[model samples]
Every structure is written in C-alpha cells, then in structure tokens.
Target: MAGNGSFWVQIMPAILFLQLLFRAVGTDGASSFSFANDCQYPVWVGVLSGATSPPLARSGFYLPPSGTFQLAAPSSGSWSGTFWARTGCAVDSSTGRFSCATADCGSGDVACNGRGPSPPVTLAEITLASPGSGGQDFYDVSLVDGFNVPVRLSPSGGSAGECRAVACAGDVNAACPSDLRVVVAGSGGVVACRSACDAYRSARYCCTGEYGSPAACGPTNYSQVFKTACPAAYSYAYDDASSTFTCVGASNYDVTFCPRT
Candidate 1:
C-alpha cells in the first residue's frame, strides 16, 4: 500500500501539471510547454506552479505597483518596509518576485513604510491694485509648483477689492503703497487718489486722482494742479510725462492707478 501511495503521489504532480497545461494550451502539447522549452524545464515548471497558487497577505507590508506611498520615516530618515504573501508549499519552491499594484496605496496610514520625504509646500503668486472706489479690481493670483491645497492672504492694512474671494486672501500690506487711496466722488463715481498728505485721515490732501467723469476728475487723466490747490486738504493730478501721480509739494510722490475691470 505504501508503494502504491507513493506512485499516486508522483502521478498527482504530473496530472496537475498536465491539466494546467491543457487549460493553457487547449489540447496542443506544442503551446502547453512552449515557455518551458525556452528555459530549464524545472525552473519554468516551478514558476508556473507559483503563478497558479493563491497569494497571501502579511501584516505591516505595503507593496504598490506603480504609485507612490506615504510611509513613516525611520529614525535614519530612510523609509523601509516589507510585504509577504503565502501560497501552497509546492508553489513556494519558485523564486519569482511580484510587485505592488497601486500608486500611493500606503498613503492613508501614518505607520506604513517604504516612501520618501513629503514634498515642500509652495506659496502662490500675489498681486495688488487700487481699483478706485465703487469699482471691481481684477487679480490673477496663481500658485507656482504648488499642490491643490487652498491658500490665504494676509493683508497689512489696505482692504482687498473683494476680500470674500480666494484671490483676495494673500495681499500683504507691504505690496500696496501707503499714499494710494480709494475715494468716492460726487455722483457715486470711484476714483483712485495718490496723496502727498496722509489720505487715511479725512483732512489729508489728495495729490492725484484717476477715475470718474471726464468733466470732474478727467477719467484716467491725472492732474498735479489738484495737489497744489489742496495741499492741506487733498489735491490730485495726472503727470503726463511720467504716466503716474505727482504731488504738488511732494516731488518724490510717484503712484500709479490701475483701471478697474
């Protein structure tokens, strides 16, 4: 009986291999063992047996095929991890390697291993403008080499054109000139004023003004004469030569007004 059992055991491997071969090659011995002929028969057979076995899952192992994983950094700053899968002892005889099947598979967990350091966060491009009062300003804020996370702006003192929107968040106070002010004139027209005096106070003089009707503020035309007249109150003038603002008493005052969209 023992001899008979050994014979049956030997026959089982052959029968199983033949069944797999027949399924793969469809009754044709030619295709059934073509891959086997290319390499050593024993090696190829062992590979085939391993390929047919069911895979096992091991604890703490994350293997992804083509994507990045977020693994915990080791004390040495390098990430390292391993994965293991079990199969029948018969298939385990082969030594072929397998790969993970996904990108960023281990990113969800904080403890998994096998990834590089996190990328750096980049700030978005910032722009500032005085759109004159009663008008909307347009700013095209963009991020350079940045991720998809939301960004915010920290304005120093000047108010944003539309602070409720995402684009208005990053306008720092340093970007805007202190002399520039948004003024509301008669008939509800908005004007951008550059003043020699501090315009934040109601008593300051306005050096140059842009926006409003052609008759009142000369719409887009700046005037230095306004600054001369209102040295103590507010004066405004458009400097045709420099294409900017020029205060009557303040020679160095140079401010530009942006058109509102």
Candidate 2:
C-alpha cells in the first residue's frame, strides 16, 4: 500500500509523543500550573495556601468605647473598632477613637465620631401646704415608687394645688381639719406626720359632719370648716366669702378660711 502508509506515519508520531509524556507526568500536569495573571492552579493554590479568603463579618451593633455605633447619640463621645468591607474608616476627635486599615474591607460610611453625654431629666418630689384656714388651700406632694410608668400630673398653673388629695379624710367620708397642718416632702426626706392630725377630714375637706351648712360644703366648695371647729379632733374650714362656714378650733391660723369671694 504505500509501504503501509509509511509504516503508519512513523507509528503515529511515536504515539503522539508518548501521549505528551504521560500528560507531562499526570493529574493532567496539575492543569498546567499557573502563577497569577488571573491565577488558576487549584484556585491559585487555594489562595496561596491560606485557603480561599472572603471571611470576616460581625456587626450586630456594638461600638461602645463610650457609645455610638449607628447614628451617634449616646452622650456624643467615645467609640471603638472593627468596621470592615472596603476599609477607609476613621474618627478620633481628640480621644474618642476608631480606626481601620490593615487588611481592610469595611464598606461604606463606616461611622463614629466625638459623641457622649446627654440623657438626664427626671425630677419629682413637691410639697406645699396650707391645709386649711380656708381659701381651701392644700398641696402636699410626695409619691415614691408609686407610679412606675403612666404618670401625668400636669397643672402648670392654678387648681392643681392639692395634687388632688386622696388617702385620708377618714377613708373618704370627707370633711377634714383638726387644725389640718400637713407638710410631707419626698425624693428623700421630711415626712413626719406622727399623728399631728388627720383622724379623717379629707373628702377633699367637707361634705359636712358638722360645719355651718352651705350643704356643709362639698361640691368642691370645700368647707368642712374643721367639722365646725374641731368636732371631736379632726377639723376642716373653707369659705373665701360667704362660701359659708363657722368651723372654729379656736380659729386663728391666719384666718382667711375658705369664704371664696
């Protein structure tokens, strides 16, 4: 035939160069080993042996050297580290520090600046009294551990006077005053009421059990005038005008006594 086609084309180029020398020594010559330029030899040798990269994610919100991780408003001062994804982080207004650079990745607007100090306004503990000579004045405030949340005692002006007294006046029978001279304070001191008086004269002071009728003064006309002058021990008085009353525990605590006029 053409000498057997030149002996099968010289044995097919020596069996295709021994199958390219056993594929350069096999495992397909480690896919032609590479070194960079978009690397590719087992993923650039598993990223130079430290294996693949892309890790480091932790930010549920905790930047408290003093406070201020998100929008900055916890006294406006003191802050700390770890904010990566594109790096470029900074902030050190004198001492409230925060930094980033080494092996960074910290993405966008990584925050933190000079911030800290602003959250304090809670005052309560008032006291004022004129428990009754009359003009119906009484305000003795003190409430500790009594109102945990829902509280709204707003009387920026008049008539809030007695903070709405309720608690003693003979358990709601009303008509108080046995020389009612109450004066308790709170927030941490002065609350001596060792029975100076108040056996019961406080239905807000009078719906009468005795006190010169004007219906014994109840509908807030406030005149128990000390139950008509210390009926037995508790007395009440109010009359600013002819609000009407004659309660007289020896009458004279500066006597104006609720006549309301």
Candidate 3:
C-alpha cells in the first residue's frame, strides 16, 4: 500500500502538468466590447477593423434607442478597430439602399464590409492587446473625423487610474461652425459638425505639407471649437497628447452613444 501511494504521488505531478497545458491551449485571448445606444432616436452602429486586424463578428447593425450590441475580438492576435454611430439611417425607398444621414460608410448595406465611415463622425477607437502579452490596451474618443453624436469609452476590470472612462458627451452639433455644420434639409437643424480638415483641405487644417508635424500643426480656431465642446476628444490630427488613453488588464469595454454623463 505504501509503495502504491508513492507511485500515485509521482504520477499526480504529470497529470497536473497535462491539465495546465490543455487549459492554456484552450483559452483564447479575446475581449468583449459592448455598444450601447442611449440616444432618443435609433442609431446604426458601424465598425471598421484596422488594416492588419481581423474583422469582428458584426460589422454594423441597427441599434434602437437604449439598445445594446456586443462583439468579441478575434483571438488569433491583438485587435485594433474603430466604432461609430450612424444617425438617421434607413433603407432608401428609391434605391433600396441602407444609408445614414451622418457617418455613412457608403456600403448601401447594414454591414460596412471593410469600408470606413464618411467623415463628420464621432469615433471610438481601440487597440486591445493579446492575452498574456503584458501589453496595455489603448483607446480613445476622436472628433478628428468630426462629430455626429456624443460618445464615451469606458473600460472595466483594470487598475483604477488606467481603467478610467473617457468621454465626449457634449452637444457639438449645436455649436458647430456655420461653415462646418451639417444641417437636415427640412428643419435646417444641425445634426453633425465637420472637422476643419474635412471642411477645408488646407495643408494647415489637414496637418499635411509643412504643417504635417505636431510641432508645426497647432490647433486652429476651428479645432478650438471642437476642443472647447469635447475636451476629452481628439479635436485635430495632432491632438494626441490629451486624447489618447490606456488601460492594463481590462476585461471589457462599454461604448455608449449619446451618453447621459
């Protein structure tokens, strides 16, 4: 009996080793992303994966008021992508095409299908690190493309300071510059705001040519309008210093559109 007990203990270590190996192989490094629409009206959520990253489960979908959708990143590697809300979307009676008044991707369908949004969009961008890589996740709310709806990116399950939520829940369209305002035809009510670069393709506003460098390209009066409204959002091409945010060991992220606070 004593010899049998000794033999069992010796084999137990090997069994434990095999169990750990199987567990590691079975686990995929994926993160959950929850998209919530808090707007009074319905909004279509659009997603575009980064050039090197794999596409998420759903590229785009119609989200009714107070509705939510969730997606998981590919487990093969780190995932990078941008999410935006397309407001006032519907199937065109004439063309039978799906389109949005703001942030339309021009796909004529619910899925963006590898297409990016047309500017005048509020973008929530994120790059999630692979599991066990010891790398931090990077995320931000960008108005550099433009502003259609208020957005907030909130990370959960990370260390306190690094997991802080970043948001730009301001009414930018209301104060949009006259030249940059995107107004609805009937009511002439401003629905979106264009970035200076989108409004005018000047080298200065576009951050190209001599103004390409961050040192040379400072914020213009146009960008200041966006910055003043959404302080945490990226106002211009070179507004990286304050706009970028990072998190370590986060389990998931909640992206809310038309966030209350």
Top TM-score: which candidate number? 3
- Give one digit per residue, the lDDT tens place, for model 3 in 1-261: 999999999999999998898776544333789989999989999999999998888899999998998998676578899999998888989989999899999999999998999989999999988865657789999999889999999987876667789999999998898999998886359999999899888999999999999999999999999999989889998899999999877878999999998
The TM-scores, one per candidate, come to 0.13, 0.14, 0.92
What residue runs in model 2 are displaced by over 4 Å at the alpha carbon?
A: 1-4, 27-100, 104-261
Worst 10 residues of 2 by lDDT: 41-50
Give candidate 3's TM-score: 0.92
Candidate 1 global TM-score: 0.13
Give lDDT per model, in order: 0.22, 0.23, 0.89
* lDDT comparing candidate 3 with the true structure: 0.89
Scored by lDDT, the top model is: 3
Which 10 consecutive residues of model 3 have the lowest summed lDDT? 22-31
Clashes of 3: 0
lDDT preference between candidates 1 and 3, better one: 3
Misplaced by over 4 Å in model 3 are 1-8, 14-30
lDDT of 1 at 12: 100
